[model samples]
Target chain A: MPVRPLKTKVEFPKMLNSERIQVTGKRVQLMATCLCDAFYDDVAIATVQVLEYLGCEVVFPESQTCCGQPAFNGGDWDASRKVVRHTVKAFEGNDPVIVPSGSCAAMIFHGAQIEFEKEADKDSVAALGKRTWELADFIVNGLNKTTWEGKFESTIAFHRSCHTRGTKSSEASLQLLKSIPGISIVEFGEAEQCCGFGGTFSVSFPAISSSMGNLKLEHVRAKNPDLLVSADMSCMMHLAGLASHEGKPIKAKHVIQVLRDALKNIGLIK
Target chain B: MAHQLIDTFATRLRPETKAAVYDGSKKGHEKRTKLLFDNYAKPDDLRKLAGKIKQHVIENLDTYLPATEERLKENGINVHWASTAEAACNHVLEIMRARGAKRVVKAKTMVSEEIELEAFLNKHDIECLETDLGEFIVQLDHDKPSHIVKPIIHKSRREIAELFEKNGLGAYDDEPQVITRRAREFLRKKYLEGDVAITGANFVIAESGRIVLVTNEGNSRFCLAATSCHIAIVGIEKILPRDRDLALLLNLLGRSGTAQELTVYTEFISGAKASTQPDGPQAMHVIFVDNGRTDVLASDCKEILRCIRCGACLNVCPVYRQASGHAYRSVYPGPVGAVLSPLLLGKNFPQKADLPKASSLCGACNEVCPVDIPIPDLLLRLRAKAKQEGVPSPGTPPMGGWAVMASQPAAWKAALVAGKLINFMPTKLLPVPPLRAWEKTRDLPEWRGGAFRSWLKKHNS
Candidate 1:
């Protein structure tokens, strides 16, 4: 199936780095990661609602699929290049590409570039990388919505996915969440540690993965937050799935889902 | 096939050992973090400088290695070169035979373990004693060192007490001080009576022909004091361009390895002491062992040779914490071992090919690395190398099928629809081993694969 090109020569304002960032043009291309498409559609729905509420037009390119992270991380660059090439064609545009996953966004920005370094598509991937932003980063930095008006009367323990280390997405999630009124952000130990949702790593070493997850959950439980929130669903899936299997299911949601709920409670979105 | 490595990992998953490793490594990680941060206002900057220095030395080995050999030779130190582990071990045996050295007390040298020196020497009727307390315990138990710096990181005090009692060191006291005293007393006579001292060099100064040894127990100092002959087994990658490099690298090594400001004893030897001096060795032998390091240096992952043997990567690794270092089944373990062991295996790289796949690519190892080695990137490179060579990796699913499905939207959509059938099936019915392994502990979310596309299409219209 051929991927239709996105609108051509749409010159959006340059990404602002000033103290006061004004997002003059708010159109963004949504790369709903495969995890959201398959298992967590609500995250995509919430993402759209939250973006729309913040006065941004979100476009979903129909030909989009997985970001080839699974293959790229597993050391199969040949297969990764095949899928990543399709992605380059799928999201070809000047509009800022917003991703809900730090891992997938990093794949587009970093991993894909490494895979295509020797190919003619390297330049195209580099351009894509410049425009790719994780969702919260797009909202806070790209869209310039630092202060959230909606109220949320629940505590959350955020899991900063290990992939988010080299990106500002983790900080953006924290900034947006803390800006909301009535939201209590609880602190936990080993906040920098991984939750063990390392794509193929979870399955390749199940006992170790489960043990690491159990350790993370124990720390999360100690904080006793109402929700386990993160920008990446891959991590949430592993933590929430393990917790459920252990008969102590915790309410887990993507950061956007929580934002959507807050906006809904305040009558900002129907 | 998963090959022999995975079986080694699975078979060594003892619960108690895992716990010991977990506790010891976590404490090390926490302590290293605190010390490094407290000491340096910008620890990462220091790490980068150290990395650049090592990289400079590695890249210009043609200049520095020969310069090192000349300086040491000029200083009256006998310099020998060994390209393989057997040759390296044979040099030590030849030295022992020449001197008719019956008893040898050794310092903690991981490279010696790489060459399996003690076993080789014992097989040749020369008695070699491990003087470092943790290494001493490991040798007594006839076990391989689990961790690079802390050989007994996987052993509890109770286990050590039993091992010591069984070895007739003492009647079995678990107190830390008592254990140390018992081992110290037993090793005291051996150190004084030893005919030769064998140790590893942390770094060799090419400018002055000096070798540095750092130890907490001062056993290396004892070894040097007692024996008239000193044999320093040096890896070819251990050269520093000048003595000034030690100010940065030694600080990093201490803080990264055991969180010490400086190891209790940082002894630097510049050949044998002047003839007027009476206390030090009369002859010094430095053996530069390659043993596949040059093979690694030739590969794209040569940045790994910058490692200072800190063991910080092992402490920070989640897999090492859970599986323990013994699972790696090599002299080096954890992140550094994962990269080095396979390359060292040469044609047998296929034997330990699974080592690279053992990581989650968490990037923690890269971050904690004192010399700023890009360990995760190196691991990925090795993984790609293995695949390019047609090595079979059992646990990793073939990406050929995934590539086909992901590249075509129509096929991907079709797979999504078919994936929902998994919601109706039992978890036990999950066909793939990776999925089966995943479902063993975690529940799968209800499959709503294609819902987002449908919702987006309608909303857009």
Candidate 2:
């Protein structure tokens, strides 16, 4: 079955940010994330565009790659550590690291707490943990900007990925969505429940994982939303994957994509 | 993949995953635990006080337990220690045989469930009756206690009504009170006439030589009052130094467990005191069962011993909400069970090897735990253990392939670029287990951004 694009129409006001956040001339190296790098190219593009719109310099370091969560989650710490070392070195400068996916951001911040053993690597990982932020969180708390001006008219149910809940508070995504003018945040009952996209978890306990996604999608169907949105592309892929196969009406999207479309709608970016 | 375990997960989770049921369970659990925790006038003070009290007990268990045994002995309570489940059951059976006690009445006790005490007793030509309403329902149906505290949580009142009918209780309405009343009427006789009563303690108070039991049902007292031989089986982890410490534990335990301010009936049993009445128990026995808990205490996951068995962790766990207790295939279930079962049972218990992998590492279980056991962290450690021990599936990578693929940036990038084409490959030919699983329910996403290296070269450069 062909994946269906979200059919919700967007409307926008002239101003993008209700209050322009002061550009600290600070750097936010965007961790385009393995998921965004592979499948959701636009999510990565949208993340960069949104950051630049906030007057923040977004850097995509070539050395940056997968955060090694796939291996970390699969209990292959050796693989995780190697990739993490490469990622740590890639994002080495003191600039705050902003990851597009909550699961990846959480891996750097929370998962890093244990993966490193040597003093130097441990210090580096902990420092990275302090600077790392999921994109919505980096936008709202890191930049101190709550409102973004955009034209969005859609009823979308939000799925807060489990790692996002584990590593950081999920209010940033909700706050950012509310900032958009015409966006209707549909109350999906199980939004906080895991979509069961636990990296290797989806594959390992596939039945439970599939059951979890179906449950989440069922909640989305109950809300009867135009789109099912989440911060983590892993969740988006898992949910959209199952929804597309099952021929469910709901389409999965990264919240960043919705925000990006709103930015374009309001002429904040073309 | 453990096909049997997967089937268990699938069948149990399918019906309950409905928004009203799944989210409702999560909501009820979170509300119950968080309300007490958040609204507690001094939540931190309470947690710290309870934590310190438990820490003190666990650290000095060797000292406190013997001291407790001495005190119980002084109070005329026969103290017995069992290092294993078989030993624990033998102790109870030997006592039951010594007293010629055939009918045994029980209260809500997960420890006995851990030891499979009821089945052992039944095999020894003894009848074991569960006096608590939920436990009774579970007993009648020959099912496992799905939730530690709420034994029949997974069973609806209608199902319960049917179970009661099957147990020869004729007809009853499918409401909670109706079923509860029927159980009350039915079990009242067992509690009054049962030759021996077996119950588990909430906390074994070492200082005063008393084991505290808190039950909402009035059965705990009836069981103790009615039997001549009363046996209290308690975990070594349950020891607390002082009786006064029950104030905070009881407060948090009740609130965190069922959202009640306190369970209606909290009884302290020191021994057979004031038992002049003909019906009152004449003798009391205290059984301290190690049952692999000492091994748990010795391990790095020892903090799991701080668990008060409040079932608060079970209340909030997403997997527990989905799979319930039975899907775990262990007497223990939920997030606490996920970590503890693997450690306590060790490698010989093969079914539990995949139990930790059952969770999504969501951290909700730890978030809601009153004692604050880092369940997700412990689960991760188990995942590492499975890998270290050469367990073949569920988080243990095959031949360290992930390490080889992930270490080389060139290989990682090549894999990324090839991910799109891999999606189109013949499904059976895909070498990766995750890829195979990912392909089962949904299509693999296409790599549309091209290899990130080229994009970064064009953009970041």
Candidate 3:
């Protein structure tokens, strides 16, 4: 489906009027992340829809592949830096690079900086971090689009991706979800616990990984929410996989995917 | 060589242990968060300050180490330095032999555990009894401490009761009070009969030459009071610059470890009791055990020395919660041990190399650390160090192969196309072992490989 840009200029809350107001017209480079490119293409598509729906021009850098997190996290810095250099060359523009996964975005902003710490171009790499934003953070904080007219009806148990802990993206996703009318967030005990999807950790230590995933799934199941939502699809993938394996599958989505459906449901964007 | 981490983890797959670890650590983590936040307006600032104090001391061990020795000597405490665990254990034995003390009473000390002092002393036919209730139970059961702060966090009350009954402590009684009473009654007698007291210092102040011991039970104090000869096994990293630093460090320790404002007993031992004094130890020996701490300080992860043995990281760690402490297969467990154990192994880092990979890098351990050790960062650094050392990371994917695909767009695109074959491939015949591990508990999402790139092309057109 072709996503058309929203023309209506919805006024943001008066408190945020002094902030950047022209984010709607700003062009953003989409970092579709390796995971989404191969598996969850719909999440990337929905993310583009939501960004365009906020009147921002979304640019997909086709040359971009992975964020080098897998290699970086796996202790192969030489291999990780090679992939990281490729990413640096791919998204070489000055536009803000937006990522749907908080974990991937963190790889750029935090992980890449560490990988390139000793290099001469480290300052430029650090500059890249300043311009990268997780999708929900860009929409809510960057675009100042907190008060959404679109309504979403569902009970969501939001899994705060552990990668989002240091970044503002986790709070941004929750804020966006809460601002939308008709959506009730089902709060569970130990809501901030990780779903054991530490990229390679999911596979390397599968038994322990699944056990941790099962603990999270138990909490998510206790609330019996209609959906399990998170800002990072990697976490959602691990969790949904675990939930399904246990014979009770959960409907998990990225925050942008949910927001896209909410806007589409309200006839706000086509 | 394959690392022992996974092999050790395989041995600790008991359901009862996992359940106990999960419940115990979760409650500890929650309690720490609540207590720290409720008590301090800016707990992060407090944690940062605590970290700064420990970091400063660690960085200046050259200055503090001699100063501590000087002050401790001036205060009439015999100062002995041990460069290895064997040497540390031998020093204790030498001290005991000189004093002709066969019966030893002990306070909980992870450093002694690191040195395997009790077992060493046992081989010498020296009776060493654990005075702390948790240590008593752990000694009774001949089990390694699964946690730094709580020794038997892996054991349920039922198991403790069974162990107690089997050991002839009493009939089966799972009541918490009864268990404590049984241990207290049994241990109170041993304290008086014990000839030498051995304890671990939580912090040794360089300025005042005092060793600080924080315990919920007054067992350390009892051990000190009951014995004329006292021996303290102190890790060289436990030195603090000033006594004033204890205010903040102690606050962080109590709140972070067990959520108490202060432990029940906080004793500061200045020296052996003077000639005119009534009680306390007549002679005191402090063994400064290096045992690879100096090696750790000289390494890239020197900041791990800032650890206070709080076990806050273990409580917050998801891996530690599920696998329990035995999985790490080290004297220290959880995130702290993941970094320290391997480093402490010195030339044998490969033995515990997989400890670094055992973590999911969730960053909770980093967040919960009282001294603000960047645990995840340290874990990553250790992994890198292991790779550089050619330590085998069995079951881990070859990052070089993935990097080749990721760095070149054409190869990446071709790989994406190949990823579709995963959907058709039977689980029994999956090419990658990690993928087989992945498929054990989770179904893979059907491959929609290269669809996004095609859609982007179509949409832009």
Candidate 3, residue A205: how far the Cα is off, in Å: 1.2
What stretches of model 1 exceed 4 Å from their correct place? A1-25, B1-12, B427-430
Candidate 3 residue-wise lDDT, B250-291, digit = tens:
999999998899999999898898878888889999999999
- TM-score, model 1 to reference: 0.93
**Of the candidates numbered 1 and 2, which has the greater lDDT value?**
1
Please give, as one word, the docking class of candidate 3: acceptable
The residue-by-residue lDDT of candidate 2 on A1-270, one tens digit each, is 111222222111111111223335577788888777777887888888788888878887765667887777666677678788878888888787788888787778767666674336687787777777888877887788888787989887877777765343368888888888988888876555778777677766777678877888887788788887888888788888887778653577888888899989978798
Q: Largest DockQ belongs to which candidate?
A: 1
Instruction: Write candidate 3's Cα lDDT for A196-264 as tens digits.
Output: 888788777776778788889988889999999998888988998987877888999988888988888
User: RMSD in angstroms, all models?
Assistant: 6.6, 8.9, 7.9
Return the clash pairs for model 1, or none. Answer: none
* TM-scores for chain B, listed for all candidates: 0.96, 0.90, 0.95
Off by over 4 Å in 3: A1-25, B1-12, B425-430
Q: What lDDT tens digits, residue by residue, belong to model 2 across residues B1-461?
A: 33326335656464633333355457668677557756676674576557656666676677777888888898999999999999999999999999988999988888999999998998999999999887888788888777778776776666777777877786857877777777788888777779998999998877788889999987888888778888999998887777777877888888878888888999988788564655568889989999888888776567788899878778676667666677777777778888878777864645577887877887677666667666777777677677667676643335356566655667767777777767567867866665666777887666564654465467656
lDDT-sorted candidate list, best first = 1, 3, 2
Instruction: Quantify all predictions' global Cα lDDT against the true fold.
Output: 0.85, 0.75, 0.85
